[model samples]
Target: MSPSHHGTEPVFDVTGVTKVYTSGEVEVRALAGIDLQLFAGEIAVLLGPSGSGKSTLLNIIGGLDRATSGSVLFNGRDLTDFSDRQLTRFRRDHIGFVFQFYNLIPSLTAWENVSLVTEVARDPMTPDEALAMVNLTDRMSHFPAQLSGGEQQRVAIARAIAKRPEVLLCDEPTGALDSKTGVIVLEALTRINTEFGTTTAIITHNAGIQQIAHRVFQFLDGRIASMHVNEARIAATEVEW
Candidate 1:
């Protein structure tokens, strides 16, 4: 997880990636010829308006969906050619996803929710350790209903990272929270990215969150309209959002 371990290899190499959704009488292009490289141990933020294709690209990169044309390479392997089973195993063994909703089991304690993934992971950290990483160790036995929104989201993050995945892809992670609560959640994510060196990519509608990322890619009309590096990265607590 050290910065030293991050070599020149790109974690993701996407080329000519395009996604087209077909219905009865219409074909919608969600992504258009996206060619980019995401390096190891870097935090990349994808920003755009609704239907701008940021979420679509995130899903494709996370293995939840596939590009209709072109190739997606992860560490030199072509993901576009991977079978269903291969994609499932790739997601299970190497990717972690967080969405706007916590999606925690109401009946299970925080510890139990995270343990579910640890049980299936190849070399997972303990549920307790995962919870502690998000600073929720004291609430290990608390149910989702018993915790606040941010706490629940942290638990969800714990569950995602319990498997020790190399990539953490979060889609609208703080969309449902108030500003104060959202800041805490962002801080937790920042901490996790720094501590684990997990290559993190966040899809957010909030433009203010761009300051927190090492690099930002702005999507528009199904293409990356702009991309820039934040030489002076802002901490989550200091982020204007």
Candidate 2:
């Protein structure tokens, strides 16, 4: 049976999800019966240390990985039941991903790099529009090598959002940048969430970043340790690294 749908439902409803990896004789359980809900148009921060299963869950929700057991419901549809091809389609149509590493093509200009996704996207914004959203319109003609680390990352963000994915999953997006640059990146993400009403989930080990989230999920030892809502959320610029 599918999850019950309601008038106001979460974009993602993850229930009893688990991931177990087997390597020879060792069994590593990355997630242990995780039950979580990500509401629409809200920013959620998954705060945890390395190997705490935050990224594991994010991958599962983004259709990049599957749960070993249990179900992941996206808009009331079970993603766990989707085939590989269906998963690819789901990701293409509904999910955007960002990571710590800025994976920009060195040979392409920022505009060209973002255009790569816009070309195939069903209903994507123009590359110029995406770059403007990330405050990189001025550097759109520059190549990855010509830009700073933060600029390259913003270009990557423009590429991700160019496709206009409903959900934006970011894993350690600011892990490699300096505090100042990280704040700038955070501001871009916040602006995207606010302007486009994108359902954003950001995974970070930095506790200070949680202040910007509408909800915070703390993970430990492959499980959610606690969850809380931010009654007094702060701006991304005010986050203390």
The residue ranges of model 1 lying beyond 4 angstroms of the native Cα positions read: 1-7
lDDT of 1 by residue, 1-241 (tens): 2233345888899999999999989999999889877888888999999899988888998899999998889999999899999999999999999999999999999999999999999999999999999999999999999999999999999999999999999999999998788888888888889988899999898998988888899999999999988878888998766
Largest TM-score belongs to which candidate? 2
Which tens-of-lDDT digit does each residue in 74-104 have in candidate 2? 9999999999999999999999999999889
Local distance difference test, per candidate? 0.91, 0.93
After superposing all C-alphas onto the true structure, candidate 1 shows an RMSD in angstroms of: 1.9
Give per-residue lDDT, candidate 2, residue 208: 94
What C-alpha lDDT does candidate 2 achieve relative to the native structure? 0.93
TM-score of each: 0.96, 0.97
| Colliding pairs, model 2 | none
